[model samples]
Target: MGDTLIDEPTDLSVRLATVFSQMTRVRTFRLMNSAERGPWPALLKAVFTTPSLTCLEIWESPWRRPEEKFTIEALELPQNYSSLQRFVYRVPFSDCFPRESKSYGRRDRVQGSVELSNLRVLASLICDSVEVLELPAELAFLLTHITYPKLRVFSVQGHEPLQLAEWAEILRSARQLREVHLQTPIGFTEWSKTSSNWIESNSIPTAPVPQTHSDDLIMRGLSNLESLTISNPLDPGKELFFQFLPYANLRTFSLKAFPPLSALGARWSGIHSQVLTSSEILCILKGIQLINLSTFEVSYSVDAEDGVMLSHISSSFPSLEKLEIHRYRSLAKYNSEYDPLVSMPDALATATNLQHLMLNLDFPERPYWRDDNLNPERYKVFHGFLESQVASPFTGAIPSLKTLGILCHDAFSSYWDTWEVSKTRKLVSRPPHAMSN
Candidate 1:
């Protein structure tokens, strides 16, 4: 049946444009192929209807009738979501299309490409105004050609590390970017050179090193960058890791400190047996002078000296509001399974401005989800970890703390979490603006 929007246009392009124009109020759209129906043009039309829509998600089915061919790029999309703020598109990589991966079973549905003919148009339109964007790792390069002047939060999925120079060059214009996250956990590998374990190797051709960033250059360039996260582990002492510190406005920062990787690269390498230490923290803080720094998070293990480190953190950012110390891969091959978190540092007690605190500690009691019996011995361990050792400092360190989050066994015990929270909350005093203030 011919619809009014189509105006009985004989040309397929005109008909599709007609559908897109009529989608005036449609804001949230999901573009995907389903087994019950092949949403040829109707589902795709959902792309343009909403001018005021703020969120859009696009996904493609991995299992489809092998013989069925799906095409997405039917026309040069003419619409743009100038007001769109968040866009999540998990398009299958090119390799996944037209060919089934080893993981796909024999009973798997047909494989085909979501030939969104003009993906560039979609990327261009959203890239302009999107503040928080999560897109396929395959299409992340599209950001290179487009400018996200308003982009504030960005995350890419692919494992490949964006070269330091390329990342810096592209972000040169993203002055408003407060958070830049790279979420490549599995497919990515990082081999960084630390000052302690650096051994210059000549076997691998490493990416060229980026030029050093001076104080003036860093401040003037990415001054607004605050929170940065990367799934790929980092070398704390490496120059690339330090290059991100110019954000005078930095408040929250998280990085996964991975062990030295033996990748195909030529740089100094050393036997790093330590987790991120307080010394590394001080080094970074000293350079950036992040007076407003609030939350500092690191993954992986840590070096000794919890006392001196925590003390510096309190003095460094008196305005600190939140502090988090999570053990990244607390258990690994070379890492021990019985490994426990470091004892609460006494220095933490001095973070007067701290409001929210999260620590990876061994909690008391057992989780209800599992069949394991409650360990009575955990009682001593929990209190000893939180109270006897750093009772005075821990309670006094963050007078402003409203929430104390802890991950025991690097997980949660629904049964005990509620009580632990209540117990800890009462032990710590609240600020004098206490109830009303």
Candidate 2:
């Protein structure tokens, strides 16, 4: 299939099927970064014929960002199209409806605008079996159209905030969803709204719908989730996520902390990124209280004062086996831009079961004690604390620990002996890296 040209292939699906049938363990089929849109018919045929394939990833030309054209010729699928488990489909769309539906959203559009037929066809085929779904914003609408009983992990791309009702319906269908990851949220934006104007002049729904039903449906579905991740969220409008704060089974949570609210753009929502607002911290505490999490990861961009937060983390999540608190872009060039971190080593000693810990924190090579206009004594104490606080309880306290990892930075090399002279385990200069939290 990779060698065959667009017109050179003949009965491609049959040949590909014959080849793939012999290899039982071959699960992933990916066609990414192609300079040209490789023979769509042959590609589709090959995909449709793979019975054992678990993951399918298809991306448009990596360098091409053209006005998307709905060129996929819709084909009839068999009564049963099952085996797929993961699918990542990223393609722009225009305003077009499905043939099976009576009314598609009243989206106004252009002639070459992408349609939903191609995406709908792909989704409908794998609706019953796919467990993990990642789609672009345009096809988020299709989430409501399919019912995936085994679906456990879901993620969405594009900047649009999903329609609450449609999203609730999707969640209701995915009763097994264990994790939900949302990235780069845009408040009050929809695929149709961003792509084009409305086809109908009257954009209002005549009937008043109850918002509580959506919330109820969403919360009920989230009770089964075990993990959740949100990255680069704009502040101001994140009502749906706050609703997920009290998940029943959520044990692992991951969030990316960005600059403070002062850095937000005009269009951005008010997300408490820096020093995570008290409410956000409360949510984390609630998650810790509600579930006995085995792992949790948090990424800090600018300011993550490790004082009370570490104490809270130390006290909460006693069952935590893996914990990661990463701070990147750590230099003093933006000294005013970020709040300095307080070294509170004793605060993290409470996690009794922790085995693997990765905290990308480092002390300055040259400890300069300077007085500040605000909290002059507090700032001086913290600076002195950073210079002196290197003793960590990663060994004896965490008896189950084996591996410890941190970003290699200058000045923090003295802690090497602390890990090297451990009672049972050795401090590692470098170890096999694990996935980011």
Candidate 3:
């Protein structure tokens, strides 16, 4: 077998077939943008022949469309499509047809039908449209009938508000689903004054439920989920902000944004008007038993007091081992000595189990402060708490604290230099000692 490696047949189909024949435990097949569409028939033949094959991935570039080259008849798969445990099909924006109104308008109608008929064996499905793709209507119907007993993950990406009712139906069917990612615009209609709730409509409403409420519905469906990542934070409907609390099983959550969080929140009346207070944060924390939660992260552009709201989060999550705060800047108005440093360490000090703490601090420049003033007297109280942990006479400050990272903005880099290295060293070297009154 080793000697055959060099002398293997050069013909692509023959080589693929030979490989399939030789590897008995072949479990994965990944097709890149360059995979020839003309050879799909032969590829399917090889796949059916390989009894151990269970996973297949096809990733096409935005610039190329392998599907365009082959007619449906020429690309038929073997009856063994059901043998696969996982299948993924990705088509980048560049690969999609140009946006002609006639073509774009009907694109979903066309592709939805093909997806339903062809990819019936998938236990797991992921589709992405970076530029923009109109998902076909049949795509919804296809999802409704598929029985993925072992299916646990589903993801779809597109710009248009694809049918969400289909998604609700799919979620209702996917008993084993633990994670779902939707990268498309979610569409819902507001009910007339008589209706108690906004209802899912067949057509996009004149004005859809602000992205906030849509996010709520999506979150509600995935209540039993353990992890979720939503790339377009702006698109999550406003009504769904509190939906996360009920997902007690959640261990990890992530959000990426094209538009700022403020703009996203503006779509929802409740979150936009007020900052998250300590009481509200406490309530959210009280709802979930986070003993199993290992990671929590949120990135938003809000006032300093708003950032302080996170301090309330530390005490409630006792089992939290890793924490991350991103895109956070200090509040400007409370730059004086009277303002607190959010006192996050006070709450964190209680989490003897915490091992990693990551804070991304972005403070704006003020005329009264110099570059070397990042950790000025105002931060003294917070720093005092940190110092006590190092010298912690009782439990030894952050006994499990092995790593601490503080990322500062460039504008404040100069402020760090003003600190006397020797004094700072002595401060940290000294073990925790009870302060004398």
**What clash count goes with each model?**
16, 7, 23
Question: What lDDT would each prediction earn against the true structure?
Answer: 0.46, 0.53, 0.43
- Residue pairs with backbone atoms closer than 3 Å in model 2 (clashes): 94-114, 235-269, 235-270, 235-271, 236-269, 236-270, 419-427
Return the candidate ranking by TM-score, descending. Answer: 2, 1, 3
| Total clashing pairs in model 1 | 16
Estimated TM-score per prediction? 0.59, 0.67, 0.53
223-261: candidate 2 lDDT, tens digit per residue: 777887665433443456655556446687766443212
CA lDDT for candidate 3? 0.43
Model 3 is weakest, by summed lDDT over 10 consecutive residues, at 412-421
Q: Please write out the lDDT profile of model 3 over residues 33-78, one tens digit for every residue.
A: 5422312455655654576776666654211222433333443553
The predicted structure with the larger TM-score, 1 or 3, is 1
Number of the top-ranking candidate, with TM-score as the measure:
2
Q: What C-alpha root-mean-square deviation, in Å, does candidate 2 show against the real structure? A: 10.2
**Sorted on lDDT, highest at the top, how do the candidates line up?**
2, 1, 3
